[model samples]
Target chain A: MKTFPIIRVVTKILIPYILLFGCYVQFHGDYGPGGGFQAGVIFASGLILYGLVFGLDAVRTVAPPRVIEKLMSLGVLIFAGTGVLTMLLGGNFLDYDYLEHHVLPGILPTGQHLGLFLVELGVGVTVTAVMTMIFYAFAGRVQAKHVQAKQEPTP
Target chain B: MTAIDVAILLFLAITAVTIARIRDLWAAVMFTGIYSFLSASWMLLLDAPDVSFTEAAVGAGISTVLMLSTLALTGTTEKASGAKFRPIPFMVVVLTGCMLIYGTLDMPQIGDPSDPIHIHPSPSFVERTQGDMHGLPNVVTAVLGSYRGYDTLGETTVVFTAGIAVLLILRRGKEEDSKTGGRPGSAAASGDNA
Candidate 1:
């Protein structure tokens, strides 16, 4: 990977656009064919491509393992916590109608949209983190094995 | 079906057969990616854009890369030690295929309005989504995010749990290394030591 100048150049050019498209898919999912799951996977693929081209160290600089671990839990928390908030707001669990209640007048759909957006965000975050972590674990372990294999030939 | 759909299906069959025949793991992984793309196109041809999008992204893109990473951990050449064909396992596969085909014989034709799947519960979801679900035009999201919110929550928890489990199993820190006598390989190394 380090020796391939063409891959480095092309990946650098393509990655930003991929990330942007992932964000578009995440946000525009309500009106389109994509949502958090697809968007998260796409976003993670961009990072994974960067990792594949540039190496795991570059990916770590972008998103360290600790940050990824925290983000994974936080995403689930946001999702479940939305339901808890709805429960506390005197509505049935996950009832988005309660979200916009009394805060804004005359816009009945605001709550549903807001709640859906937040939930999707949570899902997107969690998925992105998990996919990246899985890649990291696999790639890191393989790299370690390669180093070991090089250092000590099997007797 | 259109000619294009038939052509794509033929391509999918070819790819599947090629994947099965290929002994090189890398080629097999590439063929799997091709299979995913072809299936995604088939989904689009069937007027299922959402399913196609997911299939293209996750199946073709992410899963292929993950398999490649797994190949890096293991070996690229698949072992041919078990190459001898056994008739019993082949019979089981044939039986399963026959059962699946027989089961599908009872299914209603595609898009039949009288189909039980299109009749019950789905109509209600469709009816209420636009009006009561605050005009979220995408009925799929309305159903997945709001109507079946509990199920989605459960799925999210499942994803989180899987991530946790994988990290716990594969992640090695300085602490783990100290306990394992500084060998960074998998349990194979530990087994050898014992």
Candidate 2:
């Protein structure tokens, strides 16, 4: 079932483009319409498409469950850590103005720019991980159920 | 309203009715995706491009896929037992719909610049984004990331907690293995095996 030629060919052609677009949306969110939420979903959709075409095991191989588990928390940590860093830098929580105190006075805006990028990246990572984790759990449970049904015949 | 707006609205109404009437859960999921796509177009017409983009991606794409995956785990055929109309539930639904419609009557006209919501922080957010907020072109990002940073932080935490909850409930690996593998010929496992 995973080896269907048409699906395999089309998915192979489309996956990289979809992932690239997801990254574009993630970064361009500051100037454009989409943001972390949308980009994360699009990114997860690319992986989900891969899962749908190549089966659950293939996706697990690409993104193991343990790695997904860590990513889910890592993103949150990054977001909160940014805030804590701001606080430690003698500013209010999440205050990006204090991010680059050592930089030249003329480039103060760099702090805000970098801060926004990191915050958005954190949001994107967490959302992508959660969505993929949920899909994996559901799909894996179903697949395991099917596998069990096949392996052990019912009386 | 423009012709395009009217046409899109009419299609939305048709899709809603079809979704209600469709007996097959799978078809209903597809129709729901269509409904999201139509509403996204309407949002674009209403000049909410960001919202439209989100509606298209989350509502139409990811949600449709999730619903399909759910259908794979559940029954595709919706039960037909609801044919007999229950007057009490019907009245409840009608009353809720009427209340919702009445609630919208108090809303300011769409795109009214002077609306209460547009008066305070929004004007400042727009004005100051170019100056105090590091001259960011996207006022929405500036507002969300800086002005309302606390709110966004809380929202991220909420999402994190939801992920944890789903993992806890759905990823019960050991329990599931014990349930299925421990009793292969048991009635519950056997019923599911078929």
Candidate 3:
């Protein structure tokens, strides 16, 4: 893989834009065709491409497995916490109406806009973590099997 | 159906048959990816851009990579079955396909304005989301995020649970590896134990 300078160079140039598009899809979802799920998959695809090109060890350094495990749970917590917060604020479960605070009055209304953003963000985070984690698990198994094959060559 | 629709469907059918007939697992996976891309194009033609976006990214992209990785662990060539032709299973498949096609005869025509789907809560959701979601232009987002937030929460939880299940099945702790004298069992056997 290190011998493929062309692939390495092209991948380096393309990754940043891929990540940027993922963010665009994530935040602009309210006005566009993409939302959290699509955006998360796009983002994870970029990382997966990097892993495919540059070894798994490189990707593990870029996105540590421990942090990904924690983030996987954290995204769910963020989503449920938003619902609980709405409840605590004297509303029904996941009712975004209570989130209206009149902050930045002339701009977008605070309630549904803010709630949707936070909820979608939660979805994006969890999806990205889970997709990356699954890739790691599969690739790790292949690596482990290769190591075994090297240590004890079968007849 | 439109010419473009027919063309895509024709390609999709060809790809499916190729995947089934192919002996090489690697080629089958690649054809499956092609099939997903064609389906995504068909979804876009049906005027559901959001669904198309997801289908392209997940089905065409991530699924292909994951299948390739799985093929790396398993052998690249599918083993030949002991019995080449099983008439009972073939008959069952043909019967099921005919039954499914028969079931579609009762459904409404595609994009019929008088259909129940267009007449019911869909219209109300579209009308209300403008006011309720503060003039949000994308009704799909508003509906998923606010109107049916609980369902989305459940979906997210489902994804989380699936990840946890995969981790439990695939992950081998460093302590377990050392304890087992660095000779871990096959993934399936260990997964069963876990």
CAPRI tier for the interface of model 1: acceptable
Give residue B69's error in model 3 in angstroms.
1.3
Q: What tens-digit string does per-residue lDDT give for candidate 2 at B74-142?
A: 889988875887899999999999999999999999889899989965567577778855666887787
Best by DockQ: 3
For candidate 2, write residues A1-155 as lDDT tens digits.
44588989999999999999899988988887777777888898889889888777567667766788888888888888989998998998899888865567774436777678778888889888998998887886787778778989865
For lDDT, candidate 2 versus 3, the one ahead is 3
All candidates' chain B TM-scores are 0.81, 0.79, 0.83
- Cα-based lDDT for every prediction: 0.84, 0.82, 0.88
In the range B34-147, model 1's lDDT, one tens digit per residue, is 999999999998778778877988789889988998998888997777778899999999999999999999999778988998887766767777886667788877777887
Residue pair clashes in candidate 2? none
DockQ of each: 0.48, 0.44, 0.54
User: In model 2 chain A, which range of ten residues has the least summed lDDT?
Assistant: A101-110
Q: What are the clashing pairs of model 3?
A: none
The candidate, 1 or 3, that scores higher on TM-score is: 3
Off by over 4 Å in 1: A101-109, A153-155, B81-92, B175-194
lDDT of 3 at B161: 95
Model 3, residue A18: C-alpha shift (Å): 1.6
Task: Find the candidate with the highest TM-score and give its number.
Answer: 3
**Rank list by TM-score:** 3, 1, 2
